[model samples]
Target: MLVYGDIETVQTVKEKQAAVAALLESVRAMPPGIARHGTLVTLFIGASELVQGVVDAGFHERGFDTLAPDQEAGMACLVRLAQEVDRSWRSGFASAPPPTGALSGLRAFNPDQIIRTRQAEGYAFYALYPESYLEAARSSGLGPDTRVIGIRSIGMSLSALVAAALGAPVPFTLRPVGHPFEREVRVDPALTHRLTSGKSGAFAVVDEGPGLSGSSFGAVADWLEEAGIPRERIYFFPSHGAPLGPQASDRHRERWRCAPRHLVPFEDLLLGPSDSEGLAAWTASLLGPLEAPLEELSGGAWRARAYADEAQWPPANIQQERRKFLARAGGAAWLVRFAGLGESGERKLAMGRKLHEAGFTPEARALCHGFLVERWHDARRLDRVPVDGGHLVERVGAYLGFRAGHFPAEEQQGASLQALRHMATYNTGQALGDEAAAALTTSLKDAEALEAKVRRVWTDNRMHAWEWLVLDGHLLKTDALDHNAAHDLVGCQDIAWDVAGAIVELDLPEEATSRLCELVQQHSGYPVHLDLLRFLLPCYLAFQMGACHMAAGALGEGNEAVRLRRAAERYRHLLRQPGIRQEQEEAPAG
Candidate 1:
C-alpha cells in the first residue's frame, strides 16, 4: 500500500528532475512478483506542473493507482493494508534490474546503505536520518508506536530519514503535498520491502516553519487523513519562532478549529498575543501549582507635575519651598533624583528636604513615586498633552491657579519690575536729542497733566467700561505670548499689571498703545483694575519725561540740566503712586 502527498520542493529544478529519475529506477528494480502484483499508488499533491510530471513519470500506470489525500483514516490504502497485514513485514526481496540507468547513474539507491556510508565518513548520519524517517511515518500513518526498521534513501529525504530512524517502513514512494523534492525521491528497495511487508505501519510527518500558513496546515490535514492516523491522534506543532500578529493569530485559530477532529493543533509556547487574556488564563492552568501575579505598571501624571515645576527659575533660598510644592503636587522621589539640575548640590538637597516635609499620605506618595519611576525608566512612554497651545494655556491656568488658588506672588513682582525698567530705557534712549524741544518742554511745565487725567477718570468712574474692553482684548490675544508662561501670567494679577506697566513705560508710540489696548479689550472680557492702573502710570511717566527732555534741549546748557533733573524727579514720583506700589508689593519675585 503506497500512501503519499506531494509538496512543493525547496530545491532547484535540476534536483527535482534528479529525484524523478531516481524514483523511476527504484520502481523498476522491485521484485518481479511484487512489482507485477503490487498496487503502486501516487497522490498528486503540489502544483499542476509537478503533478503532471509525477503522472508522466508513470508511477500511476500499470499496477499503480491514484487518490486524493483525504482526512479519513479508513479511506487511506496504506491504513487498510496495515490492518490486513497485522504484523511486521519481511525485507530482502529480490527485485528486477533498473529500467533506465538513472538510479545507477545518479547513485540513488538504498538509503540504509547511504546512512552507513555517510557514517563511515565521520558524519552524524544516524542523528540526521531519524527526522526524515519520522516525517515519513507521520505521513504514512505510523505514529510513536510504529516500529520502522532499516529504511534507506538514495538522496536526503527528511521523511525517509525519520522512517529509517524509527525502523518503520519507508514506502516505495511517499509524496508529501507542498514538498516537490521529497515527492520525487526514490526510497531504497530494501527499505520499501520492509515497510510493505507489513512489519511496521504506514505514517506521515509534516514540518511546520516560519512560512507555514493556512494552506500548509490544510495540506497536513489531508495527509493525516490519507495516512490512516486517527485525526485526533495527529498533532500539528507550529515552530517556536513563528510570530503571531493579531491578524495572523485570528486566521490560524479559525483554520485550526476547521481541521478534522483527529488532527490536534499545538502552538509553540513562546508565540502568542502579549496582552491576551485567554493566554493568561491558559498559562495559569499550565503552571499547575505555582504562579506569580502579573502586576500592572504605573502611568504618567506625576511626571507631568515634575516637568511643570522644573520649567520655572527657582528662588535663592526657595529650594525647600519648591520641593514642598512638588510634594504636594504628587512628586515622586525619583523625580528629585533625576532632575537635570546644574552642578550645585544645593538644589538637589533642597528638593529632597521639601519632599520629606510635605504631608502626602503614604499611599498617595507611593502612587506618585511609582509613576515617577516608571516615567523615569521609560521617558518616551509619557502621554502627550491633548489641548492646542492657546487652549492649553487657559486650561492649565484654570487648573493650577484659578480653580486651585495656588498662584505664586513673588516671581510675578520681580519679572514685572524688570520688564518695566527695560521698557523705560528703550523708550527714553530712542529720543536723546530732538528739535521739537521748546514746545515739548513747555508741555512739561504743566506738571498736573497726568494727575489731572487720573483724577478725572477716578471721579467719573465711567472710564472703567473702556478699561474693561481693553482687558478683554488682551485676554483674546494671550496666545501671542508663550503658552506655558502666559498661563502663569494670567493666574497672577500682579504679573498682568507688571506687563501692562512695561508696555506703557516704554513710551511706545500712541498707535502701538492703542493697538495693545484694543487687543486686550477684545480678549480679557472684564477690566482688570491693577492692569489699567499700571498702564496709566507708565504712560503718564513717559509723557512727562519726553516733555522734560525736549524742554532741556531747548533751554541752553544750564537750563537743559535743570529740566533733565526735573524729568527724573517726575519719573520717580510716577513710580511711587499708590496703585503702582500695591502692584509691585503683590507681584511674585522669581
Candidate 2:
C-alpha cells in the first residue's frame, strides 16, 4: 500500500520538458516495434510531466483560485496536454509513431516545477484505459451545468474526459490534503466562490479510486457539502462502482452508500461485447489465436490453478500482487501480465527477457499494450515442492548474482545503508522492541563508508519461496522484474540486498547462507560482505514487515489479511532472534 505509491519525486518543469524533447527525437527516428514502444512510453511520461507541471504552476499562481479568464485559458491548455498524452498512448499501443508529430510542437506552458506521483494500477499494474472515464461519463445523466472537479494527480487527466463527456467547461483539479483515511481539501475564497457561485445541477467529483479508503473522495465531498452543496446535487465518478475498501470511515461509507456514483468497470472496457481491442484480441497477437477464455491468475489465484490441493498454496498478500491472467494459445498456456505502460513496462519487459536469457526464468514472448505474454509454466512453487536447501541456495545465488552483475543501474538509487538501518531499527522497535532492533544494526558501525563500498543494481527485491519455480529440472524465478523500479523506497541496491533477502526469506541456516553467498560471489564477482548482510537482514525484515502491515490494513479483516499479519510477525521473529545469520561463513575474498 504505502510502499509503492507513497514514494514521490519532485523535478523542475524544464528538466522533464528536456526529457520529453529527447524522447520525441528518439521515438521519431526509431522503427515501429517493441523497442520503439518503450521510447513512446518514455515520451508519454515526459509529456505527462509537462502536463502536471502546468497544472502545478496554475494552482501555485495566486489568482488561480478565482477562476480568472487567464487561468481558464491555462486550463484549456491543460486539456490539450492531456489530449497529447492520449495520442502518445495510442501510438504506444500501436507501436507506431503517430502520422504527424503528436504534440511535436506542443506549446511551452508549464510551471517551474512538478510533483510526480507513481501511476500504479492504471500505469503499471492494470490495463486501465483513460477512455473508460469518457465512457463512464457519457452513461451518466448529469446536465451541462454540473461543476466538474478532478482530484489530483490522476483526476487531473480523468476530469478532462468527464468534462468533455458532459460538455462542461474545463475541469479544475483539487489535491486532497491529509491522511489516507481522513482527507480534507483546503480551498481559497475564490475557488469556493467558483464552486458555489451558481446553484449548479450537480458537482461531479472525478478520480480513479475509492481505494483502501475513499478519503480523497470524502475530502472533496466534505469540502463541497460544507460550502452548502446538497448531497444529492453532488455526483461521484469513481473508476469502479464497488464499495470502498474496509478501511473506509463510517462517514465516507454512509455518504458514499447513497451517493450517486458512476463507473465503467475495467471488465467492460477490456472484455465488453463491443471492445475491438480487448484482452482476447491483443493477447491473440502474442500467442496466436486463443483457444480458451482468459483465466484470472492474480490475487494468488494461480495457486488454485497450479497446485493440486489448497494446502499447498502459499499465503500471499492479495493487495500487493500484480495483475496477471492465463491465456491458452498456440497449443500451450501462457501468462499475460500487466508489465506497466511506457518506461515502467518497457523496463520490466527487458528484465524479464534478461532473466529468461540467463536461464533463470520463463520465456517471454512479446509486449502488447503494456502487457507481457510469456510461457506459463505449470510448475509448483518451492512451498509446494521439496526444496533442497543446497540447491535452493545455489539457484537463488546464481539468480541474485546474475541480477547484481547484469542489471547494474546508472547510480546508487536504492535506499542507503543509513536509511535502511534507520527504517529497520525504527520499524523493528515498533513491531518488536527498541532493544532487539538496535543490536541487529550494531555491526554497521560506519554505515556511510560501507554503503559507499556497495555497488548499485536493479535488485531482485522478491526472494520469497513462492518466487522459485521447479520446472523441467531447472529452478526458474517468476516475477523476476518490476520490484526495484516499482514505486517503493527499495530501489536499486547492492547485490547484498538480494543475498540477505534470500537468506531471510528461506530462513537459511549459516551453512546454506554461506553457500548462497559463495555462489553469488562466484557468479557475479561481487564480494559478499557478511557484516553488510548482517545489517541488511534486519533492514530487509523491517521493510517486509512494514509492507505487510500496510497491505494487511488495505486487505482489512479477511483470512488473507490475517495471513499477511502472520507473515509480518514471522519477519519480526527473524528480526528479534537473528538466527543462523549469526552462524555465518567468513566474508568472501574481494
Candidate 3:
C-alpha cells in the first residue's frame, strides 16, 4: 500500500528546523528495521537552499536518495522499500514507469487502507499564519494516520483554529511554548444555569467601579446572554445612595422596576449599607410578595421559602448544585438555599438557622463564604508592598454624596488646578527639607475638595474621568498627592503636567524613543492640540515600542534592570497621555 503524507513548511526557518527535529526524534525512537527503512520526503517548494539542506540531512542520516520530479515549484518524493531489501518489491521497482503526473499521483494508494492494513503511514505539520494554507490542506483532505500539528502564537483565535483542525476542544496555556498545545476549560451552560438559578443562585458577579465599564460590561453581558439568561432579565444594581424619606433615590429604582423582579440591593449590592435593617427591609420590599417564607440565618445567610413545591426542586440534584456552586464561586462567599422536606406536609422553616443545621440554605451560606473568599482573593491579587526607595506617588479623590450636577467647565478647570498645587508641594518636599515635606503633607488634604469639584463638573457635563484625562492629558493627581520624597523626585509627572513633559522625562531606551517619534510623525495631524500632542505623542510611541523591545530582551540575564528602567520610562510616558482622548473634538452645538 502507498501512503501519502502532507506537511506545511512556512517561509520561517525556525519552523523548518522544528519540523526536521520532530522528524529526527520520531525516526530515532522507531524500531531498527522501521528506522532504517523509513525514507524522508518533501513537497519541495522553490526554496533551493532549504530543499538541499533536507536532501543532505537525509543522505547523511539514512543513506536515502532524494529525487525531485521536474514539474512544478513544489514536488513530492516517493519513499518505498528497496528491491535489494524486500524481494516482493523487485519486479514493481524495475517495471515502474517514469513519473509523469501531478503531485496527486502520490496519493494513488488509499491512505486509510494503508494505515489499517499496516502497510505505510504519514505525519504532517501545518504552518501558523495566513490561515489560507491550512484551508488548502483541509480542502485536499486528511488521512487516517495524518495528525496535524499547529505551530503559532498562543491567542484565543489561534486556540480555536487549532481545536477546529484537530476536531477537539480549545486549549489554554499560562505561558507560550514553541508550538505547544493544551486543552481549554469548557464551561457548561446548562450546568451553570441550573446552579445559578432558583432560590439559591449562582451568579458570575463582576464589580463595575469607575474603571470597569464599556467593553468589560458588554463582554460580561454578552457572555451571560450566551449562557441563556434573557437580556431583559439581567440587572445592574447601582450602589449610589437613595434619597432620604419621601424623595428617595428613585434613579436605580426606576431602572429596576422595568426588569423582572429579582432583588439585588441598590446600595447593599455594590456599596455595603450603613443601616443593615433598613437595607434588608428595602430589599424585601423590592422582592415583593414572598413566594416562600424568608428564612434568615446567621452570618447574613437567608433562604426564601420554596417558590415552588418541594417535589419540584429535583431532590437528587442537590449535591450537583453544591459542587457547581463551589466551582462558580471559586471560594467567594455565597448563600445557597434548598426547600425543606417534611412528613406529608411541608416543614415549618424558621429564619436564621444555626451554622450547623442540616437544612441551612446553601445560597446564603455561599454568599457569606464568597465574601470572605473574594476579600482574600482580592488581597492576594493586589499583594501591595511598600518598596524602600520606590518612586511612586499616591493621590485620593472624593465627591459629594448628593448634588452630582452643578459645577460648570470653569469650576472643573479650577478643580484641576488644585492638582498643580499638590504636585508643586510634593516636588518641593523632594527638593527641600523635612519642614517642607510636613507642609506638603498638609497641602495634600485639599485633594478631597479638588475631587468634589471635579466630580461636580464632570457630572454636570456628562463626562467621566477618562474623558477628562483625555482632554487634559494627565490623570487627576489625587491618587498621587500623598507620596514620600523619593516619589516626589523621580515619579512620573503629576496631573499638573502636560503629556509633552511626561514624554520628555520618560526613561525609555533609544530604539523605543525613535519608534515613538516615528508613530507620532505618521499619525499626528490637524485639530490635535500641538502642545499637548507634542508632549504626549513621544511618550505613547516610546511606551508601545519599549514594551516589545523589553519583552524581546527579557530572556537575557544581567541586563534586566536597564531594560526594566527603559520599560518603566516608556510606561510613564504612555500613562501621561491622560486618558484615551478623541483625535478631534466636535464643534460646539448650535
Candidate 4:
C-alpha cells in the first residue's frame, strides 16, 4: 500500500544558496516560457529551503518568528519575485537575477535533509502548481500577520507562496516525523510560545496532499491545538478536494472533516474564468483546432477502447496513474497526456523527440503546462495482433538496445541492489510464502556486485503486452516517459530489467529470448548482462505481483479487482516458471 521512493539529500543553507544562485542564473538566461516557469519555481523553492535552513539552525538562539532582519528582507525579496510570476511573467517578466545577499549567511546554517517535492521535480508529473496556492491564499481572509506553518519538503515552497499572497513575513516550516498514518510534530517551548503569543488572524498549514492519511496535516494541527491554539484558527491548503483515504485515523479524519480548507481547483487553473487557456484551446495551440471534447483516457481506460476482452485487460493503479486524454484534431487524433512542467517537461519533450525520431515511439508534439501531445496510432494492442515471435524479439531488442546505448545514466539512480532484493523478498513473502520469498533472495544473493557493474538508464518499466501499439505490423511503445522516476520503489535500473520484463510480459521462448539478447548486443554493441538478467527476472515478477495485489486490495471485490488478483496470481506463476530466468549455462532454476 506504501509506494514512494525519492532520493533527497541534506543541504546546508550555504549549499542551498549556491544552488539557488545557479537557478537564479537559469531564470535570468531564459525567456518567458514553461522552462523559465519551472526554473523560477525551483529557485523560489530553494530560497525557502535556504530560509528554513537558517531558521532551523538558529531558532534556539533567536526569539519567536525566528528570523533575523536580513533573513526577513530576504523573505520580502522572495515575495517580490513571486509578484513577478503573478503579473503574467510567462509573456515577459524581469530578466534580472533574483534577489539574495541577506540569505548568504553560511555560518548560521547546519545541514538538514530536504524532501523532494514530486510536484516540482522534473515538472513532468504532479499537475499541482504554486499559482494554485497563491490563488487559494489570496482568497483566505487573513492578513500579513497570519502564522503560516508549512510542512517540510513541499510545504516549504507552498507555504512561502501562501505567506507571500497574505503579505506575511518568513512563514515557519516543520517536518513531521513518525508513522505515515499517525504523525507527530515537535516544537520547542520557546518557539511554540513565540508562534502562539501573536494575534495572527489565523494559522495556515500549507502542503499538497491529505493523501491516504491526513496525518501530516493532523500532526501540525495537533501540535498547535496541544499548545492551546484553537482548531478554528488553523486552516489547510491541500491540492485535491478528495476526502482523506481509508487509512486516516478517527481523530485525524474528524479534524480534516471540519477544518477550513481552501484551494483553487485544477479545473479553475486549467480553464480560468474564460475558456481561453482550457484543454481544448491548449490542444489547438499545439495541433490546430480540436473537433471533440478531450475524451477522458486515464486509469487504463484506453484498454477498454483498444481491446474487446475486458477480463484480460492489464492492471492499472487508478489513483497512481497519470492524467491522460484523447484529443482529436480533424483527420488526425492526438493523445494529450500529462508529461510534466518546467525542466522536467522540457527534458521529457527532448527525450521524446529523440525516441520518436528513432521510430520507436509515437511522435510527441508540443508540451504545454506539463502535458505532452502525441500522435495516437489507431492500432490494436500487440497481444490482440497476430505476432511473429522472431519479429517481436527483433523489434523489442532493437528498441531496448537503442535506449541502453543512447540513454546510459552518468550515476546510478533508483533503489540500491540490496533495496531491490529486500522489496522482492518482502513482497513475495507477503503474497506467496516465506519459501517462495527465500527463492528470490537466493537468486539475488550475488547481485550486490552486479549493482556496481549494471549499466543504469531511465527504463521503460511498463512492458505489459497491452502497452504496445501495432500500426501496420510495426511495434510502437507507448507511455515510455517518467516511470524510471515514478513515485515507486522500482526507480531506475539496468537495461537487463527491461529485457527481463519483455521476456516475462511477452512470454518469450528460450530460442526467442536468446535471439532477443543477441539482437540487443548487435543494436547497442553492449552485451546483454546475462547474469543480471537472470537475477532480475524474479525481482521484476515480485514487483508486478506486489503492484497487482495492491491494486486488487484498493479496488476490493469487483470484476476489476478480480482481474487484478488473477494478474497477481499470474505473476506468482511466472516467478515459479523455470523458463523465466533462462541462460545457456547455469541460469536460475525454474
TM-score of each: 0.20, 0.86, 0.17, 0.88
CA lDDT of each prediction against the hidden true structure: 0.28, 0.72, 0.25, 0.74
Q: Which residue runs does candidate 1 get wrong by more than 4 Å?
A: 1-156, 171-203, 208-214, 226-229, 236-590
Regions of candidate 4 where Cα sits further than 4 Å from its true position = 9-26, 29-39, 42-80, 89-124, 272-274, 308-312, 410-412, 578-590
Each prediction's RMSD to truth:
34.8, 4.0, 29.4, 4.2
| Clash count for each candidate, listed in order shown | 86, 2, 39, 6
User: Over the stretch 352-375, how does candidate 2's per-residue lDDT look in tens digits?
Assistant: 887898898899888876788888
Sort order, lDDT high to low: 4, 2, 1, 3
lDDT of 4 by residue, 1-590 (tens): 22456544454445666776787777777776555665677666666556655544444344233335544555555566565555443343344444444234333334453322233432335667778888898998788878888886667667777887888866777767678898877666787887888664789998888777888999889889888888899989998888888899998888898989999886687654543466667678677877766788887788778877786576777767788889888779998888765446666788899999999999988787668888898789887888887888889989988888888764435677777788888887887788987877887798678876677887888887888999988999988987877767877788888988998889888878887888777787777777778778878888888888887887788777888888889987877763643436422221
Model 3, span 238-320: residue lDDT tens: 11122212222343234334532211332223123432332122223323332332223221111112212322221111101
lDDT score, candidate 2, position 175: 68
Candidates sorted on TM-score, descending: 4, 2, 1, 3
Q: Which candidate leads the pack in lDDT?
A: 4
Off by over 4 Å in 3: 1-144, 149-542, 545-553, 560-564, 570-590
Which one wins on TM-score?
4
What is the overall TM-score of model 4 with all chains considered together? 0.88
